[model samples]
Target: MLPALSTLAAPAPALSTANTGFVLICSALVMLMTPALAFFYGGMVRVKSTLNMLMMSFISIGIVTVLWVLYGFSIAFGTDFGSVVGWSGEYVGLSGIGLTELWDGYTIPVYVFAVFQLMFAVITPALISGALADRVKFTAWALFVALWATVVYFPVAHWVWGAGGWLFEMGVIDFAGGTAVHVNAGAAALGVIWVIGRRIGFGKDPMRPHSLPLVMLGAGLLWFGWFGFNAGSWLGNDDGVGAVMFVNTQVATAAAMLAWLAYEKIRHGAFTTLGAASGAVAGLVAITPAGGSCSPLGALAIGAIAGVLCAMAVGLKYRFGYDDSLDVVGVHLVGGVAGSLLVGFFATGGVQSEARGLFYGGGLEQLGKQAIGVFSVLAYSLVVSALLALVLDRTMGMRVDEEVEISGIDQDEHAETAYDFSGAGGGAGSRRAVPAPDGLPATPGGPASAGRPAPDSTGTDNATGTAPHPKVDA
Candidate 1:
């Protein structure tokens, strides 16, 4: 019966070749953002923890893709069961859906649209990984991703994008996913970090990024891929809205980068590469929801505001004492809120739909709707994510031991190292000196020394019983 139905379910309107091609390309671009995120995050952690950082982002690609195909899509976009969520099992395993079936209004095949959304689901939880870096166990982290996606992400996606979603029906404007993706992930990140506590050297140690170049590379990739992210939300190529989104994306990102650099110069007296990269990301997050509704100038304002605000927000971790390792809460959550709300003030009715904002004389109705969307998602994500982390912490242990953390998670947890310095030509590979016990003089060949050679039959040094110079070369 399902097979027969599938055969007869061909879309009524012929597929728009241009729209299908555009969506397919956009899906590919969005897929690249996850690996780009890995590099961005990998470079921000210490050398010993770099591989784990990359793994956190890369693992999401595998985990979420499978879930989306199995049941996640159904829960997010299936027949709407209520305002809170879509019906479960409606599209399980994509069962009974034909290859040629088109989504309600989209011109692309249903699977192509599903794949586009799959990229979003993959990256949303990965954003949380940045907050819980270094200390989380791989197994526990994997379990968290699976559970959090089902409990937090899918339902939220439904609330914002599903056919009968409350937020959607309330007339909220989310061009992409400021509420459902960034704010949701950011709130969840804060929740988990609160439960996990701080890193071992949160306040004392000089914990710094190992590679800024890698971070810059990741930022560039994110900027590039986001064009597809924002413009592709249109899901068709017939309209000029896609071009407007693309241009607004570029201008907003550039403006935000400048704004962040200016803020850093005033606050710290120097513009840093990391700040530039972070600012670009802040801009991207800010413009996401507002791109379709806002003009280019509005995008600039949104980006600049987000850049400055996120720059300041990152410092909140230090003041409040939460160990958000990579500032996910600062940039995503804060930036998401800024974008989602600013649209209510900046939206114009010329290029896209005719819903005007307050600045355009639409009053405060849209702003109120935006606030509802933002806070609702934030509240839900925070409570549920914190609960998930606590449960995992109790049952499977969410964090690594102190010894493993101090020794470097890459080596202790993965049994591998990110960098090897064995042949760096330190002291010409000579045996280092070792000091004697108590007040005794230091010797060249002793058990305690880092590079000491084996001693002769006598416990003392083979060449000289007398103590050599006490100095030990590095």
Candidate 2:
């Protein structure tokens, strides 16, 4: 058995070099997921909004990391308060947590654990960015992240994983973050979008993803990083549970990808790259909570189900008339709910926890518990997120001007473009703007027009008909 933590000024306890090293590596891997998410969401937006999409996810790393170091970590993992929330001020600035202090029952230092969980805190809010893509203000988004992380994420994290958390006490089986991460973010996405309303051209425009290759690349990164996210939650390398979770993750993802393709082939008559990427993510989200609790076959069932369901769910935004720009609500929220609840029927006592599902003769008890956890988080996140968005919308405004949106958010918000049509990269002096065969205006933020000396500060070339930055009218 491990020894109790030593008192202040005492020599640090001997560390488990293996577990410590493993968690550190896993922490680094998890950190990579936020940027991976940026790419995943970035590739889905139009060229004009591409960088803004990337920024929405990238900024979470900055905002949440600072908050985590201050009180985010403390509220999540600090002393518990009635199991409803942790004391946010107790570990203010991580004051009492020492560098050498070992986390209970783990070989890693408390600081390492804090940082690892911090990665989760960072990405949870970022997940909502995709649903609001193309229309929201960057400043408003940054502020929302700060507020949501403090108000929603930190407290929820405590309920799920913090010592003495209510859900932990109630025996809810969230191996990773089926509830805290995916469901919470998914519900929150739905709420914010409701308050922000639909995108300007919703339904009328095609709004296809700008770059599928980037989407594929982002999906690949998410798959690679998810191994760390799921298995790393074990907090050590000593047990077989991490390996089980790792393999479960792989099998479930493959099954979901194939299942999604099959469903698409039947419904849409063709398999697309976007479908494959979305299916893979659906699988990843589904198995996150159930990975350690089920067998390989159980993982397959979970993945296939999520793939089929989420593909269908994505269309709900259009049919129901609510815009979830990037399907964050469809994939993460729906898939998360499926995974968490399904575990109640598939969980095996012999795998990770002693809990057995109905299929294994454990009956409906566990399933009831799972439902309570899922809906509670879903309802709470949905209500609170909408309130936050409404407050922001009323005060400083949450969306960009219509003119700026039409011209492209990247150029207007960031004062830069993702692509330059000027042929400047290939050594060609300049290019003239040419209208597309569609007879629409040249893409406002598209490649530069030829025969123009250069774009002026306003992002337009007067010599040619190219307008990189269209004028925004009040």
Candidate 3:
């Protein structure tokens, strides 16, 4: 056996079935977050704009998937191009990957890693849609998703996670995507809203969420899917890091929710369901970047701080005069910054990497690195996203007509409505009077009412006779 030198050479690495399966499942969970986002944003807008808000998130799935298969993957994870971007002909269309080819040093196949990362790319641009609800045209929004993913998301992703990227090479830690996903999307949201201007009846109108239940459902699902999002970034469970990330994610979220509710009680008068849901999401966002690096207690601190900060930040739209329709900037941008920066103080230096945070005796060096990652991504996304919005506004007109803005965007944009009172009269179709038992008067005081008094233009059910709920300050 020793006679032949070829026989002694090391063989290729074999795939780890366990790691591959784990990553694949995580990919599916992350994919579910997109539709969940649709539900979250859909419930926050007025009845007229519900479907449009949903479509904004739904359309990103289609646009980003196609782009990822073509060149998005390459631009994000391909061979590095001078630290600014990545490029590799083999990664284009994923044609060069093989069945057994593992992802560099990892045991899972390259295809598995590519698809898992794809889910992250899909949801990034969708996060921006919450700010532009009820205003932007469907076609224009779709085009913006494609362009933004190409220009902003892909490049920023490379800078954070891709091999040889500047931020990655510089040792700025981001276990998941606090800086890359949340901050990037939040800054972009601010930029787009600035260009498109405020929603109709911005300050004067009492705009309220049409459905809080839907918002809660979406938040719940996002919490579930995020386990996969945060844990899967480690690529495998061979080490205990993924398990630690999972635990930190849960602890931080719970702490953040409690902290937010406490703030709401003191500042606002009562603890609203909307506040609870928003607080939970704030915790999730804050934990995303620092979860892997911090201990459970550290995660709790980060989550609590982010929760209070975001709760206060949401009111800034009114003070500063920017229409962030759904508090994307408050919860995501502020939460992300809070989480990314906190890593400098909370990182244990024993979990994901050896780098210690300030509390762990590493001093300000790591904190400075984190700051560099945060501001660079924020400044770049804000400037580039605004420029893209400006170009789109000039070319095809970003906003719907003013008349359409007043009358429900769902009907005009998608030709469908979220609900129909046409049949409120008690039949499947036809709102005409039912003849009222041999044509006698159906109602005591009036001839058979027309479909139980359809909702007025203000979207309040006429039958209830109660004024619409006052808009929450959030």
Candidate 4:
């Protein structure tokens, strides 16, 4: 008995270390998503704020990195003080918490676990910027990011994943981050759009994308990294990696593509490149929470549902008159809802234990739990994000000067340009204009470069056709 107690007290090797390693790898993959996101979003906007577009993503990496290290994780994953928040008991300043593992039946480094989790923390807010693109001020955005992460993101994360977390106790299975990351981010995107108001020109402008190839490249990278994002959520590599998740990702995306194109064919009469990208992303979002939970056929149905819903929901901004410039609210939010709710019905067996869905005879219990969790998270995130946005808007202001906006925030704010390809400035300071993310310039009829030569702006263009400047909001 004495020997047994001693052995038990000696502390088994940290299972969460393996958890940490896998998480660390997945986290790095998720971090790669930010740059991938930069290209994705950058390609969707006008050429004027191309650098600013990229900066929004890069800034989140910076802002959330600091905040997460500080107290973001504490408030998020610390011991629960109540259902709404976590206490500041562990991982503060990277102290005592790393000595023990954070997961069960895995031997991974605790610090590794923290860092892997940290990567997820960094990307969530960046995903919301899709809506408020091209107008928000840099300093205001930074402050808003800090506050949003703390007040909104932290609490919600706590409720879902932290010890004594309500959602965990309630038996809701997230798999990855359907309600926590995507849904929460989506709702916040809507709230921020409401608070910040529309862009300088809303429906009146012909804001076309400047570079389709760049957008596609970003999508490709996201696809590659997402294998890590979803499969890695299992906390360790397993035989399942090459099985259900891999197939589900493919079929769901394919189904969504078909659904979107068919919808466009019936409604708009043309399958625009933008529509294709949006559809693919919609499927990806819907599949996130259901990665390993349901059968491929179920995933297909979920993808079809999400593709149709998100494609339609995107128009809500226009009808409602909010300027979510990039549709973060539409795709991520709507798709997240569809995925999470569908999994509740379509799950193969038990609650987080792969509870069967409605069609699978799991009854309404799981579905009800899913609905409760989704709306609760949505409401919580919307309220917190709105309050944070208003705080920043009132205190420091959220938009740039109108004149600066017209001239382009890159020139007005960052004082540097993204392209110098043509030697337009001659010596050092002159530059040129660029195409929008999906646009290609008609250079004397040869296959056009996406960047058009601006008479006086920075004449820099990346390998893609974009002529961007590395300017954040000012």
Tens digit of per-residue lDDT, candidate 4, span 128-179: 8777777888888778878888887888888877778898778776777889
lDDT of every predicted structure (CA atoms):
0.84, 0.85, 0.87, 0.75
Instruction: Please list the residue runs of candidate 1 whose C-alpha ends up more than 4 Å from where it truly belongs after superposition.
Output: 1-12, 88-90, 423-474
Point out where model 2 deviates above 4 Å: 1-14, 88-90, 424-474
Question: Could you give candidate 2's per-residue lDDT for residues 351-409 as a string of tens digits?
Answer: 78989989888999888888988998999999999999999999999999999887678
Alpha carbon deviation, residue 41, candidate 4 (Å) = 0.4
- Candidate 3, residue 250: the lDDT equals 96
Error of 3 at 27 (Å): 0.4
Error of 2 at 363 (Å): 0.6
Highest lDDT scorer: 3
**lDDT of each residue in 329-442, candidate 1, tens digit only:** 889999999999998899997766788889989888889999999999999999999999999999999999999887678766666656543322223233345556766666
What is candidate 4's local distance difference test score? 0.75
In candidate 2, position 47 carries an lDDT of 68
Residues 253-354, model 3: lDDT tens digits: 999888988887777556767878888899999999999999999999998999899988888887899988888898899999999999999999999999
Provide TM-scores for the models: 0.87, 0.88, 0.90, 0.85
In model 3, which runs have C-alpha deviations exceeding 4 angstroms?
1-13, 424-474
